[model samples]
Target: MDMNASPVPKAVVVGAGPVGCLSAIALANLGWHVTVYERRSDLRAGTHHLLAPNTENNPRQRSINLTLSARGIAAVQAIDSALVERLLHNAVPLRGRMVHHLEGNTTRQQYDRGGHCLYSIERGLLNLILLKAAAVVKNIDIQFRHKVQSVDFNKNTLHLCNLVSGQELDDHFDLCIGADGSHSVIRHHLMLATQMEYSQHYLSHEYVEIRLPQGVDSSGHEAYLLDPDHLHVWPRGSFTVVAMPNKNKTFTSALFAPKSLFDTLQYPDTLIPFFKTHFPDLLSLLGEKRLVLELQSNPRSQLITTKANPYHKGAVIIIGDAAHSMVPFYGQGLNCALEDVRILSILLRKEKDGHDPSVILRVLNHYSETRHEDLVAICDLAMDSHLKMRHSVATWSYMIRAFIDNILYAISESPSLVDLSETIFGPQVPSWSWLPLYSMVSFRPDISYSAAKKKAERQERLIDSLGVAVGTLGLGYIIYSFINLNRLF
Candidate 1:
């Protein structure tokens, strides 16, 4: 029953975030001795933390940007099917993105024609689910307020400081995983082991979480104005406000803008005015009094972008935000992190099984070298999607072209296209360790990424040609009919 029992190694995981919790559970499932160390006090005591908060006294809120996309759902389902059902029941199924414009025009773009939906769920809800799942694993032990101060990789030991008791701990384990997020102590130790190429950049964008309470119509009842099936967005070029429905019949909303914009807020200043102007419907939902308190009280988080080579042999590995952190505009940050766990877990089972310690080390290293491209691809795609959502929706050319795409897609039938959508969203594809989204999503047996990419190009070309040909034929038919009518007259 114990997959790791050959050596019967003890594994210590740093951080109690979603990725760390999942990693601890996965290893414990495979019979590894998993002990999770977290610096935060018992959240059981209702302890909530915002990485950064304002000095002003205001009612604080708990909110995070998370989109459960197809790939993310698959990653989650692979780990636990029960969780998938529970999450689906709790989440607001986002059938598509609802783009709201300055001129009061709204557009809906569907991810699939069959009404298949991704979801918008609160990050804290999802994390709570993962933590609860991990809590049930028999071999997993969790130590709250145990902050890791240093790591000794050569000796495979850790020096930890207890945040609550002001105590210190030195412990040994077979593996050390730094799921402690972007500012990882374990990752810091890995820098001492190898020349790790790492870069972290903070985006000009800053995010402030707000709430859009479900309001009632003129009748004495509560209601959600917008379609609960969609993720709502008011893209204001450089700044934006987004509303995603919650199970509580409320929608958690966030406003993202530059710091300069927030700094220019005066007494009775433009913040509320701006919201009331650009997001009239939303401002009405989140009352003016509550909006002021939220902006003046809640935390303003800096958007960070990070990239790193995650493996330094068997001594260290980083998952989730610890490796790559992108702006939440694309809504894949947490999803990508969960997907990382899926990849490493599969790789550990496939390549490390029955291998010597040294052999396992080599396998881990190989997986690291291979996973970079997919990381980059996803990171890039996430970044590009922001442009399409925030700015392109307002462009005439963008609207026209997207409509054309919808029409062309309607006329075409590609097994690969259908398979591609399913595979990307399906939970059964092999974790190729490092595979393209299309290849991994579609699970094409022999199609290399280069070939798949070329095919995508050809498909696009064919769709464009069909659109042109059909338009021309329709025009010709119209002219001929007009000539016949004239002759009859």
Candidate 2:
């Protein structure tokens, strides 16, 4: 160590989830001394031991499996390619959605024609990987079981209590980041300190987890009960059940339905029958006994969509779920959170003299200003996607539009078209770009969420106009034929 070295900037991060841990790593890489506070104990130490002995037999003790798309992969790759590789190693690639219909029928809808895929990874495993990576960083200090009590933004300090020792401590820092998730204490204090406009709305629907055990295949090898390469969905009009494969050969499924529907199944007797009527195929696989046990044991979790304006006040900034929490329909919650870290790191790196305390405020202000629009777009998309997944995917009109979109994408990416256009027109002919809304949101990290929404809206309007024109032409031809027949009579 050099005696003339400048002191590193200090940062306090609340929460040690994926977003929080990644934020700590980003800050540490930027020459900031980071301290991370997590409310729960170190999850790297198996979750089974943390639960009560009696509760160890519960199957739904984990979170919904996370879907990792291009946005998330790019973010992790930006941090460290090796980290991304490790995460992918444990992931199951899902190329499309397998829509399960009534009478045991199924149809597969590919996400894109170009063979792009999203990886299904367990949330707990991903968080553990991030935590382990953060642990080895020289400048990061991770303190599990340190629950944040409150934040004093005026004094640039955090008040926390250690869960194990039952001791309280106050820590001052040059900057504070709140990645503490939906029920963030830091965000709570920031609201009190500043006029932070915030609103939270819960969907009428609720979800419950169901474990689909692995079964032996014809080859006498363990395999997923359903197609592991696609995300399986049993979509009813008002209710839906989706499943994603795990590395352990089993599938983690979630049942999303209206509160009214969930309420009707009050007893174990009603539960199995309801599954038999709605999801007959799943009922056979899950077994009546297992379905009843899961419904009786697991609690239904409400889906919430939260939004806030100006995610920063002074030197305190909020990221991930603390800033915007959306429903899981779009599978972009974690991806968006990871993008938050990536974007923030880029902005900080651009500020060459960002080590100064005063420069920190400018970096945070820029982040909040630029990030809010994208967050709003994604939240709205997630809400709208719920309806599409439940009903629209099975519609003929939706499938036709998807087919048209794929054709457009293929044309846009064709090298022959580019060459032909350049030769026929000029050497400076610009390359054409076309993408489906899903591709834009899930695969294209270069496009902003707001931009993607605008592009999709434009495409929708064009399709609607074309449909009307085609309908008018058909109606005019029918009227003409009727007039000719009447004249001949």
Write down the TM-score for model 2: 0.93
415 Cα displacement, candidate 1 (Å):
6.0
Q: Work out the TM-score per prediction.
A: 0.82, 0.93
Worst 10 residues of 2 by lDDT: 417-426
Model 2, range 400-451, lDDT digits (tens) per residue?
9999899888888532122210121112212256678899889877667887
In model 1, what is the error at residue 450, expressed in angstroms?
A: 10
Candidate 1 — which residues are off by over 4 angstroms?
1-7, 47-61, 217-221, 352-356, 407-489
Q: What is the lDDT of residue 135 in candidate 2?
A: 96
Q: For model 2, what is the alpha-carbon lDDT of residue 392?
A: 88
lDDT of 1 by residue, 440-470 (tens): 2223322322344444556557657977999
Each prediction's whole-model lDDT (CA): 0.69, 0.84
